[model samples]
Target: MEPVNGYYEASMNFDMEHVRPFLSQLEEAFSLGLDVDHLAKRVAEAEVETAYGCDLHLAFEGQPVNMKFSAWIDDIDAPDLYFYVTSEKLAEGIDAEMEKFCEAHGL
Candidate 1:
């Protein structure tokens, strides 16, 4: 939502009502070969105002792409959730594909 640096990011107001559906679509669209069950569980069990994340080793063109991802809240009392995906160094082609993927998914 800020700079187009080493990551693509997005944020929203947090709500469990939106968690499952959003995450379901996210995993389905971006998981590639990574199992996001742990991330799913962590987010599901998170307190309304809490934030956390983990690295997801998803596949891109049959090669593993490790991305650091986090779900953060701006305020504990009135949480405003945000998601960040980081890939410090990526091949040019892969970065473009990932950017397209994010755009397509409205991330």
Candidate 2:
């Protein structure tokens, strides 16, 4: 497991940097109304699984959200899994963390 950008605190269990750029690209791609299916296709084209070094998806069980992101993680060689989160909740959490990180960094 490894940390990412000092922002992701949980053990990654894999290097996901390759997906970071994809994530950024997705954020940009959202400038216009994009079909969910097409978004999925784009994600597939990004090779998110291989890039993240894990098989994961934005939705688990089923359904996506406006502000949330999710991923599955496991120990090396373990079975793939699902991870889910609400974007609103994640944004709130991240804002709090950023506030603290910035304060600590004297920013």
Candidate 3:
């Protein structure tokens, strides 16, 4: 996707089994990830109808970072999940956050 207003935007696709791990990565990358982790846990274990989107606002060094994300699961024969994260302008940069985490954790 195109960077909106010079912010780095990215989306990655993976399956349901990777959910926990992915959340861990998010937890490492963003402050909002902790709340998202709890929300995801509730939905995953509840197995009931739930909203598929979460919006968050976090401040870094007194700067506000507003983020909105959508996630869904597909279970035709097996459960598969996808996520779309779009941040207009992130100070740390999504790419750098991801690369830094992955490199540190050897992921």
Candidate 4:
């Protein structure tokens, strides 16, 4: 959004349903800095990259955005989903959306 902070994107393959929850976890991590949201934005990228051995990228509104992400279940087990985000503005929308989605699904 505002000139990429870094050139890399964090990628994780997960199930379709996991996309939202993973994003929620990330926001939780950033806000409370507890539990799995341990890595700062930068650290998230670094850690996920190292752990997965691939650069991660987030796609938002049909566009790819910079982010730190993770994939679960792998490609063989589940059709992995991705959670890619950039910009505080987008993050705001993501938080609101997550709440609504969670409420709808009783998550």
Candidate 5:
């Protein structure tokens, strides 16, 4: 397996509340068996828009890895929340899962 040490970035039109569920859905799609509530609580406590950063761990094909992520409201007048992950593989997986989930859920 070609292990990558690069970062991936993406922005979305979502809110802080959507982050946890979206992450939970991605984990479920990958059969990672993670606790949604625990992930939610972690994200809820992260410092916003600062240098202190947050971490998100994910397993890809049974290999566990972590990605540092951060989220913030892009505009005070809008609900657009921008977020990004530091792992290339995890980011790619999340993008694919999100596409499938959005199509399935009509989002």
Candidate 6:
């Protein structure tokens, strides 16, 4: 997969501890068709710091798609996380999963 021009992003407030669980859910969401192994590996190797983020590579409809997940602490002392998906299809799936994740965690 190569690079493309499309992009989408979603964000919300969540505790830092939820980051791993959210990634796990994301992995499950993409398990059926998308090869997000790179993303999973990055998430596993990620280090917690003041600001951290990672990108995953995938192919959507033959187009190379890039997805990024990031987390940081906001000024109000709340943890904030965001994800960027370069394909609408990928975004749709991830968005749905994120909504469920947020609702389940009461974020």
Candidate 3 contains a number of clashing pairs equal to 0
- Candidate 6 C-alpha lDDT tens digits along 1-107: 22235567766765545655776777676653333454434434445545557666766556777777665644323456666777666777776888898788776
Worst 10 residues of 3 by lDDT: 76-85
Top-lDDT structure, candidate number: 6
Q: What is the lDDT of residue 75 in candidate 2?
A: 28
**In candidate 1, what are the lDDT values of residues 5-27, reduced to their tens digit?**
65655555544445445555555
Alpha-carbon lDDT, every model:
0.53, 0.34, 0.50, 0.44, 0.56, 0.62
Q: Write the per-residue lDDT of candidate 4 for residues 1-107, one digit (tens) a residue.
A: 33246432334344444453655565554442223333223233332223322334544455656654444333433333333446555556645555665566666
TM-score of each: 0.52, 0.25, 0.53, 0.34, 0.57, 0.62
Instruction: Give Cα distance to truth, residue 71, candidate 4, Å.
Output: 4.9
Candidate 3 lDDT (Cα, 0 to 1)? 0.50
Residue 58 in candidate 6, Cα distance off native in Å: 3.0
The top-ranked prediction according to TM-score is 6
In model 1, the Cα lDDT at residue 102 comes to: 54
Candidate 2, superposed: residue stretches over 4 Å from native: 1-15, 32-67, 75-107
Q: Give the TM-score of candidate 4.
A: 0.34
Alpha-carbon lDDT of model 2: 0.34
- Candidate 6, residue 6: the lDDT equals 58
What 10-residue stretch in candidate 1 is worst by lDDT? 86-95
- Cα RMSD for predicted model 5: 4.7
lDDT of 5 by residue, 19-87 (tens): 666767866777655566775555565554432245656566788766555445334322332335545
Q: Pairs clashing in candidate 5?
A: none
Per-prediction backbone clash count: 0, 2, 0, 10, 0, 0
